[model samples]
Target chain A: MSIYLDNGATSYPKPESVYVSIAEYMRNNGASPGRGNYSRAMEADRLVYMTRKALCKLLCVPRPGQIIFTCNATESINMALKGYLKPGDRVLTTSYEHNAVARPLKMLETDREIKIGLIPSTPDGVSDMEWYQQELSKGVRLVVVAHGSNVIGCVTPLDEIVSAAHRHNTPVLVDAAQTAGVYPVDVTSVPVDMLAFTGHKGLLGPTGTGGLYIREGLELSTLKEGGTGGMSLSPFQPSDPPDRYEAGTMNIFGIAGLNAAVQFLLDTGVEVIREHEIELAQFLMDGLDTVPGVTYYGPSSAKDRLGLVSFNLEGQDPNKVAIKLDRDYEIMVRAGIHCAPQAHHLLGTAPGGALRVSLGYFNQREDIERLIDALREITYS
Target chain B: MFLQSINVLDVDLCVQQPDKFVAHTRASADLREIMPYLNSMFRTSTYNHDAGSIKFTNDKIEYTIIGDKINIAKFINRTELHELLDWLKDLVNDTYDSRSEIIPMYVCRKPVPVLFIYNLLPKTNCQQCGEKSCMVFAAQLNKLEIDIEACPILSEPEYTANRRRLEGAFGAFS
Candidate 1:
């Protein structure tokens, strides 16, 4: 079988339960939730509700209604950005943000006259706390950051960032797109103002599924307004939590798959998954040490990062390396800027991106061995 | 209309289909003028004006344009390659000849952007069209995978202007 290692973009070979649940939902109850009173519709609503609750539990969120289902983390980030910021709002973000956060912020910079200050980050992908504090002291309205860098797989110190923002009375928005399902994120203890997540990556759900969790009493203006299967005659958007934010029909099919994936995570345990992934990543890194002319990015230790490694062979384009990996070794990996131009710029991997091999719970030690073996061959051959 | 040269610069394994090949070709001629018309004619064609590229499938062979180069993917053998080149030549010439009759569309006529299409649609997000949301329905419409008439709200008199725009944009593809 081919080795699938591009889990950062989207996890492949999802748990059997996720696939089975999606098919069963499509076949048995494909009705739109909250739109009808029929049995199938109610079942759809129940499934969606269960999925929300599972997400809340997984993220340590207090309320299920606070979680709004979105198409993907990009949509969730857009909603958070557009909904929260007003004209002339000063925002502080890190250098390691994905395009999801950067593009929306850039648009708001023009449309709302918001000022954005990017906190300089270290080469290891950690936010420079001194610079962040200096920026925060200058009185910013909001602070947004990515919990993990998708390019280098480095996990930022969210606790410090959140506390720093909270001390300044500025709310923090955490883009947990890379860390949500792979790492243990306790929002209850962290006290982030908002957290956005995607289900397709480490969560092992299908594409077109993701969510945003808003903290209690933090009101964001609705980004979209439509029928929420309630207050149809009111001619105004609902004033409730989820209904107010979720203005469109939910993706019940994707939610069904996500629910099963979350259930699998709960059963298998997040720590267990994290350990397995870290082990694989450590193995890959250790093996890479023996391979000459191969330079890797991210934290030196696997303990400081997620389950992925970004590297490039000497004088080889990342795309070419990835293509060779796929064609010759049947190993799939992601190349290019990975939608994080700022991070690439910070890492000095710009103009040519690095090849990324992201690990998952499903990955084994042999996969890393095969990848290292192939890289050694490529480097010498 | 004869070409000076068509050189296969590279052959890479196809991502979607592993067994198939993606041959990148460097052509001597600029193929921009015929792109929009081809987008209009082919149901599978998706053109991005901003990117100045068109992606389409003809005779089960996927062709993607980037500047003057073409990446013909998912082809089996030399026969398919010859057939695709001849077909492309004929299409380019035919489109050039009938330029007056065809409106050179810059955006994708087959699969228009869902958000752009959604703006013209009734923002109801009603599931009457058997789609979860009008956005999803718009995506389906752009792919020419679903009928615009499937949406019952579009038939209403209030949405006549929007329907007209949608029809003007996608009706020919249908």
Candidate 2:
């Protein structure tokens, strides 16, 4: 049996209802959303709208129309970065952000004239809030921070960071790639201006589904131009919230699965899901800590981590360890830069990166025991 | 010298007359048998033994297969060519995989050839070239065989270090 430990990349064996709803949508109502008001097309539109509404409720944002569906977090980030930043403005981000955040910023640096400053994080994945504040003081227009570190799995203190950035009169865009569905991300309490999330990871949705939550009053230009469902009489896309950003036809089947995913999370509750995953992470960390020649990086305890652990063993390349785990024990883990070369650089895991074992709600206690046992075997061998 | 060199050229694959597989659904077991047909129809001219080696390694099995212009030529003649094309279509339909997306071939120009033209211009990424990245401009230059006179950064002493670095990175694509 293969034990999957790479949920940070994408979740596998998504909730049963999610799969069923996607199939049903494709079979029964697979039409271009908002393109026509026919029964099937309207059904598609409603399904996608429900997903936006669910995201609004889940994140405690003010309006459902503010949630714009995107192909993934990368696309969402691109839309936000390109749509928001103009030439000569400054953007503040953390050193611990994933490549989804870093790559877009780098591309923007080349295309648009902007000053981007990195708020450095400690080796344990904790960004110094004071350092973030200092960078925000430099007339920053937008602050893009990750809700959780994809490589190390530490959930940053977003409430404090958002409040600090707000003091500087800058809008904060949180990349909740790992935290959105697993934890209670109350936009009301956190006071964030925008939150970008991937639906396939913790949300248990199909791939090609993600959204950007833009709080009211944050006006961003649209990246793509095309026909929106409403206001056909107007030649240009409406300057409203989502239709302004979402130009092409929405992914109806994907939105159906996303809606089902949100329902599953709401039923079980985000807090319960977070507790289950954190317990698994703690279990794995404790076992790995006890073993000889194993070195785990991140928050020493699981209290600060979401559900991910990055580690390396003595005299063993993380790539080699990952291969051994797969070939011998059928245990899957990701090894290498994890697409966040800067994050790995900050944690001293650059060039050749560390072994990342990220957990999900589906991971059982026995899975944790199996991983520990396999590590013991490799260490002894 | 070319034999000693390893080039990681970007490859774009396509099945000529793909309308045949519009309705085809099954896949052929011998995937290699279908490569030649594609090469012949796609205007592939050169064939190299060491050039088109496709290796999949997992620290076990170490499966090694080679597919060059010649193999793609043979692929065009297989009895199961339709089935092979059908498998590719099915793969695309079932999963949103970019691996199945065909990207055009791009060979990074060698530094020696590039410098002959680059020597005339300032080798800067100052957006004076109207390109976002200098490396991207270099790739475009290779495609057009055009000289690099538009760059503003190359004239500056501060960008002297970057010019050499870009040359080394683009040198591998050759």
Candidate 2 Cα deviation (angstroms), residue A348: 1.3
TM-score, structure 1 vs. true = 0.68
Candidate 1 docks with a DockQ of: 0.01
Q: Which residue pairs show collisions in model 1?
A: B111-B142
* Error in Å for residue A297 of model 2: 0.9
TM-score of each: 0.68, 0.68
Against the hidden true structure, what lDDT does model 2 obtain? 0.71
Give the runs in model 2 whose Cα sits over 4 Å from its true position. B1-174
Least lDDT summed over 10 consecutive residues: which range in candidate 2 chain A?
Answer: A37-46
lDDT of 2 by residue, A195-269 (tens): 899999999999999989898888898899887655455577767667778887778788899999999998889
Q: Candidate 1: deviation at residue B24, Å?
A: 64
